[model samples]
Target: MLTALSIRDVVLIEALDLDFNDGLGVLTGETGAGKSILLDALGLALGSRADSGLVRHGTDRARVTASFAPLKAGHAALDLLDEAGIEVEPGEPLVIRREVKRDGGSRGFIADQPASAALLRDVGATLVEIHGQHDERGLLNPRGHRALLDAFGQIDLSSVAQSHGEWRAAETALAEARERLLNDVSEREWLDHSIAEIAALAPEAGEEEALAAARSDMQKGARLVDEMDGVDKLLAGSDGALAQLRAATRRLDRLAAEHPLFAEALAAFDRALIEAGEGEDSLSKAAEALRFDPAELDRIETRLFDLRALARKHRVEADGLAALLEDLTARRAAIDAGEQSLADLESRVARSQSAYRNAAEALHAARVKAAAALDKAVASELAPLKLDAAQFRTAVEPLDQSQWGPHGADRVEFLIATNPGAPFAGLMKIASGGELSRFLLALKVSLAEVGGAGTIIFDEIDRGVGGAVASAIGERLSRLSDSRQLLVVTHSPQVAARGTQHYMIAKTSDGTVARTGVRSLDAGERQEEIARMLSGADITDEARAQAARLMEVV
Candidate 1:
């Protein structure tokens, strides 16, 4: 609730401080008495558009401060402040201040900390609701209708929101899976052919190098085999070097037994034979090792060519072919598994859809029931406000699946019919200005415990109505005030008389400068004011009597 407001050099308000209280507070005065100026000052504090014209004639700047007592714990406004990194201590007042300079620029503060006008406006919305000829929020916007109905019905939307989230998640996963499947379909045939070719070749690690080495050895051995055969014939053929050495060693051994001098010559001859025999044995083994088969050489060359061709086709090194083959095989296996994976994702999407449908159906049912009750309650308040023939409705229309949202699949709107045989239309379209205020009043009274701000200010709700209609408006205001604070600017005597607190706004001049001043009226002062309202500019004895009677009833 707004606890106090201070205006400094704003328009004709030079300097003023007004304290406020809970319940219905009324501001009453004659025309051109600056009641609108007070509202303007309040709007400025609430971050409305700033203008240099709002500054007083001689002042360089104008300021307005609106103070509110601490809101209830967990208020949405406090959460907004927290999100902005602003600190507000518990049990402390929430002071919103705005100042406009003559240069057409303005500044705002919340709780004495610098703030943006946007933030001030957001915070102000949580503290007070202003219903007038041009209010865009509250019961006016159809966007807020669903939440209002939900609050009135005490419906919980957590399950609905949760289900919607799950459904969207499942939907997204399915979309990605389908895209992957489409891409894979284009590559499926290529994958099958490549896997088959790799399997047939059956490339192995180091096989390419091993085959190349054997081919080189066979080519070199073809040249060396002829030289090896020549050396073997030289060492082992008849009458060759080894045969002559063996005959010389036998002659020397027979001579050594007959003559001592031949002993030395026999030993040298035996050594020569031994050396020649070793040379012949080495040549024989070399001739055998140099032998090569033409068929085997052809096979090695063919194997090498096959391996190199496959490596080029796959755009990899000969040694890397085995790894590439393994990778492609894994890809084919994954494609085979994709079918099962797709089935699981489809099942998940179905489950999520069912969950969301169940929750939305339940929410829609509750809203339907609540809409009927709200209509009934609002209809009951219409007759007393002179809208006896008018019908108030809380219309819940079904929405298509594409329009469904986290809230539900229903579009809620407030509708009204001004007279019999009149088709129900939007609240804003069908009602006149005076009728709209009364309708809003009736709606507020019915939804007293539903969606509303802590404080509500109605601008001239009894603008053209008087007599019993004025009395009815006053009574309903009083009733609405039972739950929350209400401030009304009125010219009606009946409405003025119902205020628990009364203020009088008047324009005064000190010869040079004119200013607007507001004062809290005492009991006698209220009587005089009410009397003035009843009898115009003159207050008569009968008017006082009537005022007294009006005050006595409430």
Candidate 2:
């Protein structure tokens, strides 16, 4: 329910704050008391279109805020709050604020979080509904008829919607499988040849890097072969270092053997010759390791070339060749089993279609039954409001196959005939003025529990009737307030008196700018206000007595 409204510099309303209570609250005053301005301010906070003219004179901007505290956990507005990523704690109120600048720019906020105007409007719709003589939204809109019917009947449409989704998915899968099969069959030979080419190379993950490294080593060895050969010659035989060292050591050995010091010198000469020979043998082994195989190099280069060429043809790097082969092999396997897979997919699609059709039929059946009960319920409400001859019915019609939707295959509409011998037509086409207003009220009462918002404001719903008719409308509005909050703007004293709380919209001036203000009326104050409504501009003693009687109506 809407708990409060705060308006700042909006048209004739300047810095006004009003707190609202639950149940029926009526606003009554003389003509041009700025009641419409108050409604406009509330509408702006609810994300209605903003006009630059709405800003008060000399003010830079206008702001309006509406606060609501839904008593029920499953109130539809709660889902909208979650969707906007706005969290409302256990005791917090949902605050929607709107600002309209003098230059025609506007902004909206949900719980102080900036939001798009469209989202604010959607969130607002779930929280409140304002019904009047020419309403085109909510219950009166034909586009939302099916949803309203489903809500009224408490129908669970998830099964039908889920089955339809599954059916679409299955159909899509079958189509994709067929497309793949057709493509693969047309290119079967090309696929076969490609598979063989990759298998023939038999590439490994790291083969390219290894081959490139080996080629590099071999090429470098070829460049340094001459220097290695010179080292081998210096350690060779005869005139090489090993042979010259051996000849010098032999001449020193015989002189050393004649004395004790000479024997030690001969042992040193023997060790020196042995070291020279070992150096010559190490050189020989180093020369042998430097040997390069040109043919092996050629083979490695050719293999690397083949691997790179295949990778280029397939648009993959050499290392990816292995995985690519696996994928192609899988596609080939799929081709071999394509027919069976296609058949299985077709069977699945058939099953899903059958399931969707069954669910849709069930929904259609449930709506038909609910429609009958709703028509009877609404019919009972019509006569007491002075429309005993009027006929009301909920029409359930089947949609074409192309029009069938997730909700089901039926289109629901509320049709009515306001006179005897008249054919049933849409509610708007046949009814006008008081008849139309009463019909909407009757329909609203029938769907009050299921399809209404938490806070409903009726803009002069008791417009075209008085006396008994006015009392009947007030009684229903009072009854509606039992479940949800209702606010009515009325000229009828009876309707004003039915309200659980009364507010008087009055315009005043401070010798500069005219301002609009609302005051909640107490019991005696409410009686005077109703009396004013009863007697117009003059307060007569008889009007007060009648107003008191009307105040005791509930």
Candidate 3:
């Protein structure tokens, strides 16, 4: 229920705060009293498009705030707010505010948190339903019709639908796998050939690197042998320095035994002779190591080249040959098992199609039964609203099974005939604006308890008809209030009298500016307002008596 509305600098409204309550609260006034302005302000707060022209002449911005108290802790609006990342404390009122600047920019807020207009609209939809000349008419929507039928029948088809969805998803996955396997089967011979070729290669890790090293050593071996042979000849030939150094070292040793100066020379000569001998031994080892068989080197180089060429041809690194082999093996296995997998998938798809068909059939049956009852109820309501000749019908057409959707496998539309001998057509296409409003009223009265919670505001529901028809509309509004809050703006005295609370929207002006204001009328004030509505701008004794009578009936 809407608890309060505050408006600041919005067009004719400079500053105002109005509190609302449950039941049929009616706002009545003469033309140009700003009754529509009040509703527009409320709409803006509920996330309607913002207009900079709505701001007062001297004001920089206009703001509207609406507050609602949810009937339960887990209302859908609270959940929507939670999803929007807006916090709402338990037991606290939900406050939604919208502001528009003079520059045509606007901002929305939910629970004091910055919000987008789109999000505000989403949350607003869950809390209030506004019906007007061009606003949302749930009765005309087939989607809403299906929901109403389910709610009326007290059926929980969501779980069935969920199961159907899961089954379909599994079937789809199985079908994709089967398709891949079938494709593999067509290429089975090619897969087998490729797998065999990769398996025969049997490439091992690090073998490529070892072969590369062996090839490099063999390629450089000839030059290294020539250099080592030269070094060996220089260090070990008889004419080489080692023989001469040995004779010199022997002469130095004989002198060292006689004098200290010769002792230093003898020590140095001995160290030089030992160093030369070590160099000769190192050269001999090098020459022996440089010796290699030419055929062996050529064989190693050819093997390395073969491995590299294979890696290039296969579009893989030498080290990745093992992984490639495994992949080819898996492909071959898939080909071998293809027929079995395809059969399994076909069986699963068949099962899923059957399950969905069964569930859809059951739902269709339930809708047929529920629609009959709904049609009868709505027809009964039409008589009192003065549409006795009108016939309300729900046309359920079976759609293709393959086209079945979340709703079901049927296209359900609400059809209506306004007069006898007339063919039924969609209500929106056939009904006039006034007729549509009354028809909506009838349908609402029929499905009063089935729809979800939130405030329902009917703007001038008494547009075309008057007298008894208006009274009936008022009576239904009152009835609707029993389950949910209803706010109506009307010119009918009967409607005004039906309100648990009455308000009058009036235009007042200071010397400089004109402004619109709303005030909750007391009993005496309400009677006068009702009389005014009954007698135009003139309030007569008879009008007051009639207003009193209407009040008595209410």
lDDT winner: 1
- How many clashing residue pairs are found in candidate 2? 1
Ranking by lDDT: 1, 2, 3
CA lDDT of each prediction against the hidden true structure: 0.90, 0.87, 0.83
Across residues 116-192, which tens digit of lDDT does each residue of candidate 2 receive? 88888888888888776676667778888888889999999998999999999999999999999999998889889
TM-score of 2: 0.82
Q: Please give, for residues 327-347, the per-residue lDDT of candidate 3 as tens digits.
A: 878888877777777778778
Stretches > 4 Å off in candidate 3: 56-61, 70-74, 78-91, 101-103, 178-197, 210-293, 400-403, 464-468, 509-513, 535-546
Candidate 1, 13-38: lDDT as tens digits: 99999999999999998899999999
Give the candidate number with the greatest TM-score: 2
lDDT of 3: 0.83
For model 3, name the residue pairs that clash: none
Q: What would the TM-score be for candidate 1 when compared with the true structure?
A: 0.77
